[model samples]
Target: MLEQSTRSERGSMTGEEARRAVREGRLSCQTSSLAPGYVQGNLVVLPQDIAGDFLRFCQRNPKPCPIIGMTEPGDPHIPDLGVDLDLRTDLPGYRVWRDGELVEEPGDLLSHWRDDLVGFVIGCSFSFEEALLADGLEVRNVAEGVNVSMFRTSIPCAPAGPFAGPVVVTMRPFSPADAIRAIQITSRFPSVHGAPIHIGQPEQIGIRDLSKPDYGDPVAIRDGELPVFWACGVTPQAVIAAARPPFAITHAPGAMLVTDLKNSRLSIL
Candidate 1:
């Protein structure tokens, strides 16, 4: 077991180190601002029997389910992600689902691991959020030390097999000028959910209220600031819930798989 320590101590560790901590039970919390500069991902593990359909679903909806890394059936190591990465434990948290209904949020998936399960790692906004912060744009959720606000939209995802549901999105409030810069900065990292899906009207996207987000904490949207929405990795969680697969596993919202890939490497220009 890794030695448990304070958040401040964990914050200074490298992505690999952070993942080790998670695997050893030394850390289990939202992975938002931790492991800075590395690409973080949303994870979805499913039985091989249904993996093909889910893969197609992600292919059809690239914005919300961009593929970053995938593993062979029952294989936990994604060498391209991290040399020693263990899919069942590298993430800070995991959500177990049965027939699409959430069963539990466990610290690790050790007991649940099966020979037929396959892992899919989708790109997450944390990669681009790092890019935005590097450009001096403030990410409100990070500044306030909270999970990024996420909501479900009425926008329907293209159906594939048993997977189909509304798109899920994460919101960040920014001044008009900053919002423009954000769009430009994020556009360079399409694999991690590029550009704003919607800029100003929250209601237009079916977000009834900014203060009451469906996932993560709500941050204040001051006057003159617009809430910018990005297609989120959490979309798969919604798909899993709606599709009700016999068994599935996913990283808990805001709790991600930290990889050795640098966020800068994900940039196209």
Candidate 2:
């Protein structure tokens, strides 16, 4: 569990400062509340042999796999994202997958790096959560100091090559009025998942219970609050698992890559 004190301290960090802390092993917690105004991303590393196919998968399903930054095979630096970014040691945590099975969750990928590896950074809801919070909408997970609840849905993502799976979603609860405001606020940031995909019905998306989520922590829904679901970056990990790629690496849920890009820059409006 992340200490609320830690969250509060890191919450005010600049994107570069946060990444440096992660790189230096000073911090290894979820990026959810860290680097407040910057874009935090989902990391996906794959061998060049499968990178093209995965790229197509992201293209086919933009809502869940919006590409914010990508690196050439074997190259660790995406200069556009940060002047001194080092993919091998940047993210708070990473899950290694082999044959679609998660084998290990490592803090860094130094031993796992290879000449054939390619890196991708997908936009995460953390970006738009900043927008919603700025608009005074309560974000339960953030307020409760836990990961946003995420679930696998009956809805399917458009398949591309070997990547195909259920569309994964992150959930937040709000009153009807705030839900509408959240919709309007989030719509401005399409790259980070623009709007709620499903509202008021968990069973419709194959989610049996709001108390039990497939990923992240579950938060309480007060009376009169409705659960809202949005496409999540975890969809790529789900696809990677289903496809059983020979090898893959992705950020652990909520433990994202804090990039230098500001969240406001990703807003469409």
Q: By TM-score, who's the top model here?
A: 1
Question: What number of clashing residue pairs does each candidate have, in the order they appear?
Answer: 1, 1
Clashing residue pairs in candidate 2, if any?
A: 100-244
Candidate 1 local lDDT, 1-269, one digit each (tens): 22476767666878898888887778777776677888899899999999999999999999999999999998988999999999988988889999878899988888999999999999988899888888999999989988889999999999999999999999999999999999999999989998879999999989898999999899988899999999998898789788889999998877889999999999999
Q: TM-score for all predictions?
A: 0.93, 0.92
Give the whole-model CA lDDT for all candidates, comma-separated: 0.90, 0.89
User: Residues 1-269, candidate 2, lDDT per residue (tens digit)?
Assistant: 54333766697889898888888877877776687898888899999999999999999998999999999999988999998898899898889998888899988999999999999999988889888888888899989988889999999999988889999999999999999899898889888888888999889989998999999899999999999999999899888888898899988866889889999998888
Which residue runs of candidate 1 sit more than 4 Å off their true CA positions? 1-3
Candidate 2 structure, TM-score to reference: 0.92
